[model samples]
Target: MQFFPIFLRSEGARIVVSGGGETALAKLRLLLKTRARIAVHAAEADPKILDWQAEGRLSWVARPVEAADLDGARLVYAATDDAAEDARVAGLARAAGVLFNIVDNREDSAFITPAMVDRDPVVVAIGTEGAAPVLARKIKAGLEAWLPAGLGARVRAANAFRPEAEALPQGRARRGFWAAVFDGALDGRAPEPLDRLLEAHKAARPAVGEVLFVGAGPGDPDDLTMRARRALDRADVVIHDRLVPAPILELARREAEIVEAGKTGFGPSTPQEEINRLIVGRAAEGLVVVRLKAGDPSVFGRLDEEIEACEAAGIAWSVVPGLTAASAAAASLGQSLTRRGRNSDLRVLTGHDVNGLADHDWATLARPGAVAAIYMGKRAARFLQGRLMMHGAEAATPVSVVENAGRPEERILAATLGTLATEIASTELTGPAVILLGLAPRAAARSLPLLQEAAR
Candidate 1:
């Protein structure tokens, strides 16, 4: 980010503004909201400035601003219309080692004022480094409308109990108490609940940690469920797989410890035992741990093993289902995994099993109307081709390979079973891919023109 958002302590601080017109008034209006001692220096002042001075709202210096004007100022704003004057004030403020902003001049300014949401102790600031003031204001307006009017009051009431909460010990006990309050365990909708929560929190014990197995969906962050998002938001640690997209992980709390437990098909992978141990270990430390898996964790994600591990360790755990690869692949192709007449049952098959090259009922799968979505099938393409062909399956049976389904870079390669292996071999595949058997693409497969091999 060009400008880092931070809240400065304005109470008892000194701030100086140099201008008499609307620009200065705008800056003063925001500054007045803070408890800072404000000083305005202008040769000619606006009537509002005079009114504010008479009301003891601010101090007005009836002269041009000089270097001395910013001697002890924590921040300075130069809103003068004259460019030279603004520059001079900026230079003086910088030389005095004060953070300053020159109105409409971001290049020379040390700070830019952000569109703010004033909810007292629950303030929110939105800024675009002075590049998009209108956008920032729009965002601020949206926030103002969405936030309840009594939010500030509720937050202040909670703040009053912070001292006692802090005394409870520095750990999850204190944090969980506040979390419970915000979660409406204390009825944050009203003020009386705050008093009750404070009294009850004093004797409350620390909450036990939990493990949540959350499905990240097929590379699309928007596909994530609300429950999964909340789990990520509250996660103290996240154990993620290789295929989970970065956007989905971005939903996790910034303070959350992200541990890569990525397992690649036919490649180097974290041992399942080690991953299980890691989850249990983190949860044992009273941390909310999330085992983030790509797509639906229940579908060939080795979820049962992890869940069993948690159960054996006496760790509480839950699951948040997500859109599986089959669904996403079908969506990308504008096709369906199961059709009313074509197929009554849908099967989710893995390309390989414990013995490698998963063995299934080839006769049934190769039946004329059969359909299946195959996961991790890219490497076992030849094996699948041979098996289906041997079982009296038609060489013309349609097949499609969806690479990185639901991602921006997703691609669909379609061909008959006769050329499925050849098409996949000639294509450059990246990211996790899933194969659809007995399902045709919405349009004809665009074949990758292959160069004919010269006779040996």
Candidate 2:
């Protein structure tokens, strides 16, 4: 919360770094990434500075900075350990109308250098506003994994087509053309400018925007429902999860702009407010956006909020119900949740904190003859199962956990309900998961052999 993030391009900016020690050298190294014109001033410097100067990478002044040094410079940094000199240099830099960072003296600074992660044209600046540098670095490290490797190239590719996009007629048709590009259709790998021109001519037909609420299933691509697969093929943009099957994403229109709408609890995320804004923004632009969710959009998918947002914005949205994580998990084990004549009820629980409706009876999930399929309940398995015992469910009831269900590399671990805690704790599940509880599972297990033989 301390930092306001930003990204700035320094292509034409003149940057002057005043100092020569390791700290100054580090700052200069980061500045080097900008491709900005650079000048360095220091009484003495590390060997790396001399090497850089010798290579003509940067201009070096042997003496301290002067008034003229700040002229026309966009930014100046004083990293000298001497507080007095740092202040004097900062004061002079400010007078010259340049943004300046004074080493370790944020109070006297006109500008504080933000922690940055650069991927040209896709730079991410982390500003704690001078508060949490460690948190900023941690955030940067996390983002490194999520950001694409060739983002700069992809962004440059997007930029290259702006003029053509702007020239296209206004309305859904023009935006749809760009939507195809975002979906990876217009990449240089595909065709040429002529093809785009041809497509534009064909696109004179009326274009209308549609919304598909797709269930991402679990973390396995094969777990995707038949309808989901077809939906993905028609997707213009996939609003997906961190846990959605990667292969599923790859199957979508390659130029599809993927918006990470997954609510990964690990860090701050696009609030529902902003996500709703983004969804309506792109949809209003006439793109077919797939509002992808991890499981069945009906089963605990925050459809209420999303639907309300769309209705408020007067955008057309539709739900394409998917196999919820519970169904996929149960199916992976060949377990029929609503097995005829036995499990009269099939229950699904959020398992996390819930408010409203006079406090949920968590113990009902443990009731016999009712299949209890827990979604995202791993964290509370011990407590959940224990509550089941208190409520009269057998301690040795059959329990199965399906991880990466329906994947080619899928793994199913079986244990008594009592031992699920140890199994889940020790199980090497690296993706989203589901928990199943039922007496019918034993019968389901018996059917797997026949099912396996049938597949052959």
Candidate 3:
């Protein structure tokens, strides 16, 4: 902030150089494009500078700067070996209402050029404001990767569309149209002039309040439906929960602001009401907002309040469903919740005694040939099994304990209900386990290979 940032064009302007070596020659060659009236004061000249003098590209005098160097000079550069003469010329320029730069001496000069990134006519000028040119160059290099080579052409293309945007009557419709265009959301060349299309776009602007409920899905990112991916990509801002992994978050647009609502079982979570505010606020700003939650939003996810808020705001929104962990767990273990006549009923429950198991109808668990998917039932499996047995349930029932379902690291334990405790005790696996209980048909059952000897 301490350094002034300004662009200078020396065309038909007066400027002075006080050096004749490679440094001065290089500076002079760059200035020739500006068509600046440049005069050099040096005792000796480099070969390039001498050739330019012979060709009349620039003019120079001998014995460095004397009294005559300040004549009509608007700017002066003290790029000389003699520090004493550089200071004298700098002082003269200062008294003559001129800007002087004693090269490399920022304290003694008015201007200090920076190592710039010139993708002109789309130049990105990075300056430390003369604080640190080296640091400025480093910053420029980092930006070189993301910036396209044809950025100058892209800038020209955008400028060409200014006429189309201005021709439309001034209003929110017109402003919003351009806002969506130059918002940097779209890259590369502008499309063909589609005036007819613009009218349709302006007329069909999206609702002010609309929520896009996105499903984070079970652990794996690939399991996310195509609809879910599109929903995330269109989101102006994302209000994501904890279970949504970092990889899934990367799929969102770079400008799509991300806000973490620590809704995970254990984490630094954002409060629910605040999350609701963020989603609604972004949507209200005519933004496509996505609320990302693990599993389907309507399930355990606090979709109730979010839905109510969206409804109250009068926003148009939709839901994108995902593969719930329960289904994933069953699929990973090659088990089914229902098997034709084998399982007449299929039940899903949380064994964590959400409030109390006494309130739960444990007697329904005694039904014959019924399948049950128990979520987070690893620790309470034995207690639930005891309840089932007491409720007239058969002691021998096929059960598969699936953990880390449908992931690269999936494991399953197949055992009878009576040995549930003993079987789970042998496996040290933990974290979000599910239990699939029922009698499996032969095709669904997993069996070890048996050696069959053919007598030869």
**What is candidate 2's CA lDDT for residue 174?**
64
Top candidate on lDDT is 1
lDDT of 3 by residue, 147-253 (tens): 66766665576667677767565544564565555445235545444465467655774546468898888767788899988777777788887767788899997
lDDT of 1 by residue, 1-456 (tens): 877888899998999999989999999999999999999999999999999999999999988799877878999999988899999999899899999999989988999988899887778899888888999989999988877667777778777867767766666667666776776422335444755666687777676788999999998888888998989998999999989878888899898899999987778999999999999999989899999999999999899999999999999999999889899888877787888888999889999986899988999899998999999998899999999999999999999888888777777777789998987787778668898999877753233221121111
Segments in model 3 whose C-alpha atoms lie over 4 Å from true places: 1-192, 199-207, 264-271, 353-359, 421-430, 439-456
| lDDT score at residue 361, model 2, on the 0-100 scale | 69
State the number of backbone clashes in model 3.
3
User: How high is each candidate's TM-score?
Assistant: 0.83, 0.51, 0.53
In model 2, which regions exceed 4 Å deviation? Answer: 1-208, 219-227, 266-268, 354-359, 439-456
Tell me the whole-model lDDT of each prediction, alpha carbons only. 0.86, 0.72, 0.72
Report how far off residue 213 is in candidate 2 (Å). 1.0
Better of 1 and 3 by lDDT: 1
Report residue 183 deviation for candidate 1 (angstroms): 3.1
